[model samples]
Target: MSTLSERDSLFLEIAVGEKLISAQQAKLCKEFSGAVSENLVKNGLLSTEQVASLQQKVEDKLSSGNKVAVAQVEIYKEDTLDEKVVALAKERQLISEEDEKNCRKQLKKLYDLGYNPQLSSILYSAKCISQEDLMALYKEVEPNAKVSIVAKSMPFSELSLPTVPTIGTLKRKTRHEEVQQQESIPSETIHMLDKMEEVVSQISAPEIDIASEIAPLKQEEEVQEEVQEEVEEQPTNESVAPTPVATPMPTATTVTIPNFDKVLEYLENIDYKVTKLQQDQKTALTEALSHEEMEERFDSEDIPDELQRIIKRLRHVSEEEVQVAIRDGVGLENCYIPKMSSSTPIVVKKVNFTNCVIDQVDFAGVQFKNHVDLGNSRFLTKAIFKECHFVKDATFKSCEFLNGADFAKAKFDGKTTYNSSAFRRYVSFNRCGFGKKTVFTRCYFAKGVKFGEVEFTGPASFNDIFIDHRFYMEKCQFKDSSTFSGARFADIADFGRSKFEKETKFIGATFMKWGSFKNCKFSGSANFNTMNVVGDLAFDNSTFESVVNLRAISASRNISLQNIKVGNEAAFKFLDAHIGRLFVSLSSLKGHIDSHIQEDYHVARKEYGLLKNNFREINEYDKEDWAYLMEKRMERMEMKVKGPLSALKRFLNWLALDIACGYGTKPANIFVTSLAMLVFFAVFYFSSGTTEFVPSGELALDHSVKIEQSMSFIDAVQVSFRTFTNASIEGWVPYTDSWLNYVMMFESFFGFFVMTVLVVTFSRKVIR
Candidate 1:
């Protein structure tokens, strides 16, 4: 063995303390775990007390299930635990060249750790958990393992030979034989009577089992009493007799028919009551009626409640048929016969079109156990079941109506589907409740439809529905926002006249024609932000409770928002497409008055100024281009102003001057001559009368002498010129002279008029 130095012994002790060893690496480094003890015993490096401390630390960590590499332990030898690991690794040469190259890609430079701090921490923490786990992950990349498991055996096995159970065969009558037996029957057929009795028995409450146990004696007594009463009353009605009581038939007993015209007549004559007939009279009557008569009776509005009750009892009877008279103009009562219930779970069912015409249908009061299908059925022209009760699933799939359908106030407790139904005229479902997922997908409306107060308490979908005319859903409440995505309107659709009492959506809906949303009120959020309209979009007086999204829309004509109000942050945002024109009235934009409105006002004013300048510049160009640009400028200017009044006045003034210039007179000469004539006329009109006086000789001589004395050569020449022009010898006028005063008044008036004309002309040309 080589003699060890203090440094080597310390390094081995530290390596053991820090635990930087893998199991394989530990094989090479584990000797260092006790290096401090050995070194102290040999008096080589560390003191015995120091060696003891180091051993305790390493052992404690080992007992705690911690794995330490040799390098990590070595780190404790020279420096504190906070010292860098890479520096220690470099000093010790713990990694081989190939390992160093591989680790370099991940470790790289120290500063590079900041770029992916999360990834670095994950890699470092993973290594600290277990060296084996890190090595396995690295080797996964190197081996390119597919890492899939194959099935070891089959999950199940097939059975061997089986035992078959034997069933007893029974003899049954053939259809021909049964027909022959029915022909031999003479009196009221027992099959018809038995069926009628069964139907009547079936009419009782569903809890008959429990009720029968308590009232079995009472029920028997009541039946006997009813029988006694019927027998006594049977002879009173001369034309009809009661049905004879028959023995109880087996559960599967079949019924055969007999002509029921006489029995029907007897029942009708007695107002649908057969005194001699037992409780089974209902099934018996239906069995006697023919198919044609049954259809006619079912469609008739004149059906009495008692007759309907009998018809319903025999509706399912296989044997004896009944005749139901169906004549036009006859009112049918209780025509919406109650439907049958089965034990099976029905997801979707439809049984429409059984009757061509029905009136006074009372489905509003009945509960359906399963989906009710009513497609392509014609109801009476005024058929109404506005408040029907639906207990289970219901459907009106592809139903067509010739008259108005009133389904207002109906309650649907399950999913309802009305896909492809056509309402030829008005249909009102004002307050119906669709409790489950209701789908009106692809329904067509030829006229106005109202669902004003309908409550949809489910995920209602009107996806791709067609409205040929108007669809109004004012004040409608939806528990969840109903989707009208992909719906198409063929004509003017008015949603503004409707109310969405809750959140409603029309995302991606296509409005192919004109649409009006005037005064439609929303109490909750509405989303029509991404709607696609291929026609005019008008929203007058519409109020939105939440944000209105008109973010991205393509409207062919104008989008008029004359008086609409939105409650929250509006998104007329991100409109980068060509908007034909946006007409937002002043009052409607009140909320934006301080911001967009003010900004737009200033911008409009600036635009008008720029347009005016543009027009002026264009007029200086050649006629053709000037005309075109001027037209464009004028249009832009018109947009910026109330009207074309300012432009018209300027044009008229310029035209008048141009016309005057076209004539022969020089403009300056005409102006000067006109001014001179106006002055002469004013002088003539304002003059007071001229006065003549005789002068004394002395005064005249004095005047001549004074004139001679004042006359210089230039004065004499002026006097001679004045005389040649027939100048009058007029005396100088004083301030108080009448003619001079009149002249001054005329001059003042003329000056005032000239000043007024100048002011008016300047104002017309410059101010406006």
Candidate 2:
């Protein structure tokens, strides 16, 4: 048996202890699992011929095996349990869209275990699902080997067969004949009334069974005798309604008809008792009357509630009346509508105040229950809405404010649209609450817009808006999609410490100063494509439960991202971000931050230094050394200018340090490379046999053919090594000042370089 090397023995023992090899295989190697793997082909346990035969036997044994009831390749399909579970949960109202997303993420981890982990069981433990629902889901993911036999509870009598009525002596109407009679009515003539009549008649006089009724009465007579005995014991007066006497059957001569007016009157009265007639009457009155029809209906004196009366009276106030009321310094109740919820929502057809100039207006605490519109209106001096309430939709589209607008701490209960509106001075919506969707599409802010500490319970938008000064939106909460695409912030814009429940978008945005989004939480994806920033941008300490896309972004200054947490790091991709100075982790930012090291190394070097410190703190000495070495290499490359001497220095640095020893990251590479170089030179010298050795005058023979040709290949190789090593060749030597002698000298110096590189790399690896 061949003796095992010390390293081999150690590796084998570790492998065996870790169960990487089987105990049965150890028996063949004389009682050790790993020795068999290393020495099966090493130790002469069997003859070479027997080994070959045994290998053939093993292949035949494995290939001849079969598994019963195995599904075919074409039939065995992979089922995505996550998609199915998520869809089912949504359909059953068991989870919200956000919760469903979270569950699907959990399901992916379970799928990697080969068997579907009991997610339903986990939900059951959390009281999120019922046992019955869990059991139903369990059937889908149960192993194919576990068979369930479900026995139906119903008997044969419960499943009815198609009825085949027996032939009778009397003539009876067929269903097809009845249907034909009903279809014979003229298409233009409305049969809906006749249908109602038929329905009423059928309900009043249903089909009767004489035998069943007579038998029930006979049983009642017997029950009457028993009741009489009980009546003697205890008597009481309780009246029961008598059953209606059955109508006598008509003879062959009799016929029946009906009056249309009476029937119509009865049906109308029944309909009026319900709300159908009242609603229809109001709708018809609304459509038939002129502009005066609703005026008298909204009279303030007739309304019982004061709030509703005030709201109703506003319908009669014309544009001139409103202007007059404002000019006279009217209170909120006299000018705008009062909020009332007694009836349906009041909708004013039009609130046109276009081209009207408002000198000053303050609606600090007024409430409006109706829709408000001030389209194209101009606010010349001041407009204060510090705590105004809008319980319905409001629009200020195309309106302009010359002085300014203040909406701080305001509340919007419905959609608030500000499309194409212009504010010449500072506007504030700070600490405001938006209970529904709000839009600022194409709006212009000359000074700036502040929205810090605001909470948006619905979707919010700032599409195509222009801001001329600093914009602040720090510590905000967005419960739905929040978009700012195509918007421009002239100065610094901060959205720090914000929480987004749905997708947050900032696509095609431009920033003149810093656009910070630090310490944000995005439950959905954050998309920031095609953004251009002149100054610094930061997204430090942000968490993304979905992918955070930052593609096609440009920044003139530093673009920083550190401590980013993603739900699935492998699924993220950052493309086309031209970083001036990138701050990111190497392990997580592989291939994404690979370039721009030469362009922005001045500022990026500081982050690289920090990365080196981090790696050292983590006890990853190898990575720490690599980080430090790379930082130095970049610094060195930056030190030299782009010229002839610089180019020459770089070329020499690469050849001596990088290729030979991997910039001192690898020590063993030097020895392997040096051996390869020696072998290469030796082969070349032996094969060509061009150089002839000058002989000493010791009665030597002729040198017609090369002397190397007379020597064996090994002897030629020996001669080549001796020449490279500058060893004594005694009587044979290269001609003085010949190319061969020069080549020999170069090889000697090259060997010294190789040795030096080996020593430096080895020392670094050991010390680090």
Candidate 3:
């Protein structure tokens, strides 16, 4: 080897600086050059001036007997940098020969900067299958390099990453070095193995269409990463954890928080506050006032200028206080609530409001000054108006409540209407008191709606309210007639322990889900006519003081009436309600009766008696009272029939007397004429014998007895004509005993009757 002369070294350094070589490469190149720097310069590896100056040094170095290395001369070239990196990386045996070749091919396409940290680690770990694969990956991910938003604001607490001490890394390196030294082999042996590997890699390597295979893998991984990014971008409920916040205390505010105190003082100093006064004080004071009223009173102690200044200060303070209070968390109060007038009834005014968004406005204890209009406003935060009084008519049509709304303990003195308000979140009017007519027509309650302990003193109407969640009205009182016609409850509806003092109508209310009236009391007429229910309708332990009308309710499930009571007639005339209870006790006057007799009436009476005897041992009279009452009812009917029978007999007697009085002796005369006609026919039948009689004398006489056939009409006429004068023995045959019996009976019966009838008839005819 030969040493490099100063001039050669200087040229080499300059060339290295100008992309000709590297320092380590210069050392390696000069290690075997043997003073042949001039030859290297002549061969265009070094500068020309460097070669002419280094000829004598080359001779001196050859005379010194040193060897040199030469391949590092091109270390600064693009290809040389890559080759040296590949050779160094291979010397560590960190990757296989095939991987090294493939990686070189991939790294050739990269910018001359360096290898990727991940790709280099992978290659050094011998985990990379091919360099072309890694370069394709680098190209695909290069465009995707971005600052992760998730990691920007992450703190140690949020990151939850495992930590390691600095000493642990040094210890790990030491252990790694020990493992490497144990596996260390001879460099010449490694070189030989590398050569063998190079030959084997060359022989076994398959030509790859990088655009098809490696590029596609990179594209697939990129697509997968994009999908993962999209998934990460999606909003999740778990993304924001609930943090604790301090709650603010409640504050009270008065209406029109007195901002014009100064004006009021000015008016007072000018005697404007004193509009009227007594006659004596007005004449004595003699204060000049505008409008020439009969009298005026003024405090004439020379109105103090200091008082005016103080009033102005008070006015400023009051105004600022109001504004600050509102800024903190105050809502409109008296601006929404107005006083009622005694002469004219309050009527709801029509007003259109648009694009009104109120957030975090606490309306608790707030009132309106005039008839309010909230047409299309939005209350997106907690709204409360507890214990506030409204004196004028108010209308809230098409108002949407997107958050919790509280109107607890609120009182409306005038007509308050909610035509189409939508409560999309939790809404409550718990312990609210309404004094006048309140109407909620076509309102929708989408979440929990609570009216617990609410009291309505006037007529309330909920015409078409749709409650999609739990509707609780526990302990609420309705004094006037309340209507819930065409209303629907989609989920569990509860009116447990609610009181309705007047007529309550639920006409056409559809409870598509379960309805619970666990212990509700209806004092007046309760009409649920035309109600369509799909789920189990429970009215257990409910009381209806007046008529319970279910005129046309259709129920698909079992409508329970266990322990339900009605005071008056319980009408289920046109109901399609499924008969759920086989032992229902619904009476004509009181519906859903709870009498023991009804229970026994439904049960087999005998069976009930046996059960009672076996269990409670009820008295025999108690068991048999029902039977006795039934028998007594039957006996009472029988007694009534007997009395009517006696009256009917008396009526018949009176009718007979009336007939006798109308046709007095005419009936007797007709009777006598009929008797005479009967007697004559009888005598003719006996004397002119057409009748036959046979006597039983002796056997000999019977043989010679005359037998005659009954005569025909012509023969009978001839016989009767002959018998009028003399006896006709051939055609008319009669026995002597038969004639005597007929004539005697006719004479005896008809003689007196005929004579009396003749005398009466003669007397009546003579009198006429």
- Measured against the true structure, the TM-scores of the candidates, in listed sequence, are 0.32, 0.38, 0.35
Q: Over the full model, what C-alpha lDDT does candidate 1 score relative to the true structure?
A: 0.44
lDDT tens string, model 3, 475-535? 8899998999999988888888999999998899988887777788888877888887787
Model 3, global lDDT: 0.47
- lDDT per residue (tens digit) for residues 252-347 in model 1: 222222233334444544344554343555454553444334545555664445545544443241111111221111212323432222222222
Per-residue error for 43 in candidate 3, Å, reads 51
lDDT value for model 2: 0.54
- TM-score winner among the candidates? 2
1-768: candidate 2 lDDT, tens digit per residue = 345443333333333433544444433465443444435556643345544544453343233311001000011224454345435766778756654444344344324211133333223322355534533443444323122111111101101110101111012232123323543423221233222322223222222222221111113233334334433443233211111111111111011112223333343433223334334433322222322233233333523354334433333334455544434433222333212111112222323444444445556766656566667665654577777677877778887776678899888888888989999888999888888898999999988889989999989999999999888899999999999999999988999999988988889999998999899888887888888889999988877676566666777676666897655422232355555655655555442232332255543444445456656755667767666766666665566667989888888777667666677677777887777777776775556443544443332333443443333456555655665556665534444534566766787777777777788879867876
Instruction: Write down the RMSD of candidate 1 (Cα, Å).
Output: 33.3
Candidate 3 local lDDT, residue 588: 27
The candidate, 2 or 3, that scores higher on TM-score is 2
**Candidate 3: where is the Cα deviation over 4 Å?**
1-355, 568-583, 586-768
